[model samples]
Target chain A: MYPKKFENLIECLRKLPGVGLKSAERYAFDMLEYSEEDINDFIQSLEDLKTSIHHCERCGNLSEDNLCEICKDNRRNKNIICVVQHPKDVIAMEKTNEYHGVYHVLNGVISTSKGIMPDDINLMTLLDRINDETQEIIIATNPTVEGETTALYISKLLENREVAVTRLAHGLPMGGHLDYADELTIIKAMEGRIKIK
Target chain B: MYPKKFENLIECLRKLPGVGLKSAERYAFDMLEYSEEDINDFIQSLEDLKTSIHHCERCGNLSEDNLCEICKDNRRNKNIICVVQHPKDVIAMEKTNEYHGVYHVLNGVISTSKGIMPDDINLMTLLDRINDETQEIIIATNPTVEGETTALYISKLLENREVAVTRLAHGLPMGGHLDYADELTIIKAMEGRIKIK
Candidate 1:
């Protein structure tokens, strides 16, 4: 058995997503054995993360201030907006280094089972941002049922206006075998095929 | 890519065992999302672990002060000392609720491959603790080759002393099948079998 103070450490570690009792115990021992300077650095970093990071007012991405770096960059195409489900999805798309447009994080996709709707997300703000100058609205949502439903709802809402809507092309993974491909994926790949030049 | 301030949080999370790039990224995000009050509690608990936990002066086990509860208990037998390689091992043996004597932690085991010798361990303090009143010394090292070598070396060093030296019994685990056993495990089990009365 550990001391009462160690119990507190275990309890705090258990709050982590995947950490359980044994993992919490191992983490407590690791922390107990670490040098004072290293422990202080860990704790200080956690505090800094809590205090310094905030959401970007324009794009809903995480940043240090109201405006994220992408929103503040004048060189970027403000007329093209890439709609994503979460801030992490924006980062994942950014890693590809292909898209030169701005981003709009919806924070979550529409889920009827969870009682989430288009109004519950940042859809109104996105509509307000749309103008005659806006050329494209890329629906970069995930390839899930909820993502497809959300994309359809957004597309229908923008149909009354003059903005062009597009979705990411779906296909098998780069290294995946066609023999193991699922029916839905093959159907999507066929439906999203491009025309020859 | 992340900001310089966020880099520290990522680095700290990466240092943890089994936490790779993706896991570190998730942990950093979780920390960034944690509330200020939760961050304060985490920092306070870390500081408490550093300032409050101390090694037991007699056995080197973790304690709130110089003496652990087991070492300070007047009813426990002081003549027999169980020597372990680390404080976690002490907790494991204690969980069995079988041993009721004091303990001596070597802090680490002797490993020539790692440039560690007998002198590098806390063996000298253990020798100093032995007296005429001492009866037995249990060597509860792990079953690794390094652990066996350390146990053998300690047994040889104490051969001339009056105290009786012993080791934990080893064999196949309960309900284990022989066909699934490894060669080293079979050898250990064969070497440790007892004769019937």
Candidate 2:
């Protein structure tokens, strides 16, 4: 409905994840409200993101260099790795501040419905890392059926290997209200309950 | 936290309307997934939005040139002008394709809480245009207290003018369920109901 330049921008923005036509236009038009200096800075930020970043060669996580900050850090638990489905999960886990271990991003879970296979993910590096002998491998994929299937597959592959395999404990989240928890969640919480010594 | 470049991009994205830290990170990471050429093209789109567009001299609508497309197009009804709060509203009205008239963007509504006054809006050129003798002025501000206040203020200002002052008729929106319509909206609908001859 707008000019070619404006419409082209909307189309380009729609290419971004989760952004629909209305949202793309909103983003474009909202950016127009920003000052020239701010807009230039934003453009510079985008350029930097594009030019200076890549997947970490070691862990399949995002990085500016060959190794991500977590993999490069000597202080972090180098022997322990938490396997997640995406980089966003890495960010989410990092926010907890409870886990100081490194991460291995599988990129995506095995989903036949989505046409995603084991080969399509960053599983090769994970298998190679496991063969090299890690202290522990924590599977922290989402609690979905696909996540469970992927976790089970990876655990089975690492069964013969000399590595401790663990899954994120299935329970109600720490801050979650008990009253709001569904029957399945309640059951999982009850089944996963641990004795405090 | 991620690399400096990635974090910077997320921060910049967070400046957009309705985008939170999580969504901003998602946008940055998704953009990272795009090829270099595609990312560069997106950067160009943003640059075009920033550099090429400005308010129309005549109606305060968005334009690459001095006058917006609507103002430049002589085929549009110059005699009837619809007053709106922003360029977004202009697009919304345009989508309906019901109004052949031009528009005058207030740029902002008068909000005491936000410290926005009538002086802050694009009123000077509106007065100049009105003095040039438009046949009608349609106030299409959002149906809020601020909108009604602005509409009434503008109507009072144009009391002595020859132009017919009109407000967008307030009523239950077309296809709206009566069960969901608020009491105020129902009252407005009743008050504004037309006799079916």
Candidate 3:
């Protein structure tokens, strides 16, 4: 066994995602060797994370203020909204540099097995944000069952509304080998095939 | 592309061993979900690690007090000392429930490639601790080139002394299959093999 404080630090480190007992112990040992300034900076950062960051009131993305960077950008298309499962998906979408639309983060998808319902996530706020000027509503949730369920539920809610609702294309990704493509993806790709000629 | 404070927290988490950018981001996100109490507790643990823990004055093992638990214990053999490369090795040696002697942590091994020399570690302090009451000095460093070099160097220094110097035996570990054993390990096992009656 290690000293009391050493063990306590290990326990704290172990609470992080994917860190095991060995890794926690190793991190604790490594952190002990860090300079006082580095330790203080780390502590300050953690403290700031708790005190400063909050979800964007408009789009549900992480933000230091009420609105996120994307939501505040005037050039981004407010009429076209891309609905995603989490704030991280907003980052992924931003990396593409193609879509100029703002994002609506659901924070979670509907999972019946996990007992999460339609009312559990940021779904209704999305509907509230849609105005007469809103042109397209893109359902960009992951292709998983829960993501599909949430997407379908959102589309059903917008059925009476005039806004165009579309799901992201499901197919074998670019640069991916055909042999590695799964049956479901191949089927979806075939169903959504376009006539190039 | 996260918030400033979120990015700062990720950078801090990335400094930990085996944590990459993605993992650090995930840890930051997960930590953001932690209760204020939990975050404060983690911060307190890190602070305690810096303030409370110190090297044992006698054996160089990690301790809250001036002397380590083993050094202060009356039941342990004061006549024998196990010289290890790091404090972690003391924990490993203690787990065996054998070796009732106190430990001397070298903090590091002599490695020419890494530019570590004899004077860089706790080598001289070990010499000071070797009094007339000391009987055996067990070299429990790892069986690497640097470990072997340090062990040989220590033994040579104690050649004229009354204390008995010994190296830990190298062989196929217990529960190891011979078919899976490496050639060097097999050779060591053969050399150290005991004759059956």
Sorting all predicted structures by TM-score, with the top scorer first, yields 3, 1, 2
Q: How do the candidates rank by DockQ, highest first?
A: 3, 2, 1
lDDT per residue as tens, model 1, A35-143: 8888989888877777776777788777777788888889899999988877666666666556688988887789998999898886767897788999888876766
- Best-performing candidate as measured by TM-score: 3
Cα RMSDs, all models: 6.3, 6.2, 6.2
**If scored against the real structure, what TM-score would every candidate get?**
0.82, 0.82, 0.86
Q: Over all chains combined, what TM-score does candidate 2 have?
A: 0.82
Clashes, model 3: 0
TM-score of chain A of each: 0.81, 0.81, 0.86
Write candidate 2's Cα lDDT for B1-197 as tens digits.
78888888888889878999868877887887788888788788778877777788899987888888999888899998988888777776676556788999988888888898889999767888875558888877766778768878888888788888777665746533332445566446434533211
Q: Who is ahead in lDDT, 1 or 3?
A: 3
> How many pairs collide in each candidate, listed in order?
0, 0, 0
DockQ of 3: 0.68
- DockQ, in order, for the candidates? 0.44, 0.56, 0.68
Worst ten in a row by lDDT for model 3 chain A: A188-197
